[model samples]
Target: MKPHRHSLYRTFANAAAGVVHAFKTERNMKIHAAAALMVFIAAALLQLDLIRWLFLLLAVGLVFTAELINTAIEAVVDLVSPQVHPYARIAKDTAAGAVLVAAIVAVGIGIGVFYEPIRGWIGSLL
Candidate 1:
């Protein structure tokens, strides 16, 4: 008998659960979650233009997605190799580096989107 396909809601629920799992299982994911929350809050507080908000959200999502993938890669690598191996180390490091690159790009995007607004706020406060 063929397995039943999940409904749309079930798929979305599973995806959300996986995201939560990623955040719980990965330290970097937790950090990314905190940063993403801050960016989201700042965006709302600053009342960013639609385009700017979209860009910020996209960047934040990219970083989070990259981190989740990195965590998955590391888990698979560890499961396959359990023992320390140079190739396994390389695989894990490469996955981590990809996440780092995504994070850096996100940070740059966040700065570009928020710098002027933040500076103006600081200026007003001084």
Candidate 2:
């Protein structure tokens, strides 16, 4: 029998598994994914330029990173406390707050990037 391979590929595979787990188990992640898909489709339909696309990608990355970190923090807090505790609550709340901040920033970026184009499209419909 052949032994298992250990390489950078394995590391990335494990990382992808974590992302899949998050998407499967987290409701917010699913929402984020749907929003991302919508943004990409809208961008394509609107013929958004490269710079705007880059900003949108950065916003998505920021939101996903914050969400994953928040999940990690919550898991660690739960593992350490396992019961109701003020510090655990504080830690979890802070992590969730970070996700909220990231999400808000992403919304700002999306509005900045898409608002004018969408507004123009709506005006053209009249």
Candidate 3:
């Protein structure tokens, strides 16, 4: 069978819908979004250099991408194997692990980018 085709608008709308669904249903998505907001606020306050800003943006994107993929994997596993199964459990758990790894990397990037500015800001306050 030939593959189905979608209009550009439809493709974008579907992608947006997935993002909305994840944010609405996934607790982790909310936490990531909140953390991202705080990071941006701090970056603004600190006047991050362009390179640092790019790093922060990439880190945030990585976390978001990982989380979205994890959510998709969980949904597929649930649909394919609704009953409890070892393989299904493995699939879901590993997908979650990916998110954990991404979050850790993002944290490291945040610390690397923020450490100097935060330290200086604190020093100036004292």
Candidate 4:
């Protein structure tokens, strides 16, 4: 079979469609998106420096990337094994585990980035 090719615009559009689909269908995706929004709002309110912003952005990006990958893996596993199968269960579980790990790492980065600023803000209130 000849390899199908897509224009760059079409490629990005397709990717965007996948993101929309995930956001619409997956509860976890919505939760992650909400968390990201809150993080961005906090970053703005705190007036994070460039380095801190970069760290938060990277952490958030890592989480969304992991979630997207997990969504894709779950879809493929479901497609291949519509029936319950041991390997399919393992694949889905492992992908979920990866998402959990990414979220935990992001939380750690968030605390590290915001701790000093928040502490100072609280201190000033006293």
lDDT (0 to 1) per candidate: 0.92, 0.94, 0.97, 0.96
Tens-place lDDT digits, model 4, residues 24-118: 99999999999999999999999999999999999989988999999999999999999999999999999999999999999999999999999
Pairs of residues at least 3 apart in sequence or in different chains that clash in candidate 2:
none
Candidate 1 local lDDT, 1-126, one digit each (tens): 999999999999999998889978888888898998989999999888999999998998899888888888988998999999999999999999999999999999999999999999899999
Candidate 4: residue pairs that collide:
none
Ranking by lDDT: 3, 4, 2, 1
lDDT (0-100) at residue 27 of candidate 1? 84
Better of 2 and 4 by lDDT: 4
lDDT of 2 by residue, 14-123 (tens): 99998998899889999999999999999999999999999999999999999999888888998999999999999999999998999999999999999999999999
Deviating ranges (above 4 Å) for candidate 3: none
Tens-digit lDDT string for candidate 3 (1-126): 989999999999999999999999999999999999999999999999999999999999999999999999999999999999999999999999999999999999999999999999999999
Provide the lDDT at 64 for model 4.
88
The lDDT leader among the candidates is 3
Instruction: Sort every candidate by TM-score, greatest first.
Output: 4, 3, 2, 1
Better of 1 and 2 by lDDT: 2
Q: In candidate 3, how many clashes are counted?
A: 0
Scored against the true structure, residue 1 in model 2 reaches a CA lDDT of 94
Clashing pairs in 3: none
Evaluate residue 15 in candidate 4 and report its C-alpha lDDT on the 0 to 100 scale. Answer: 100
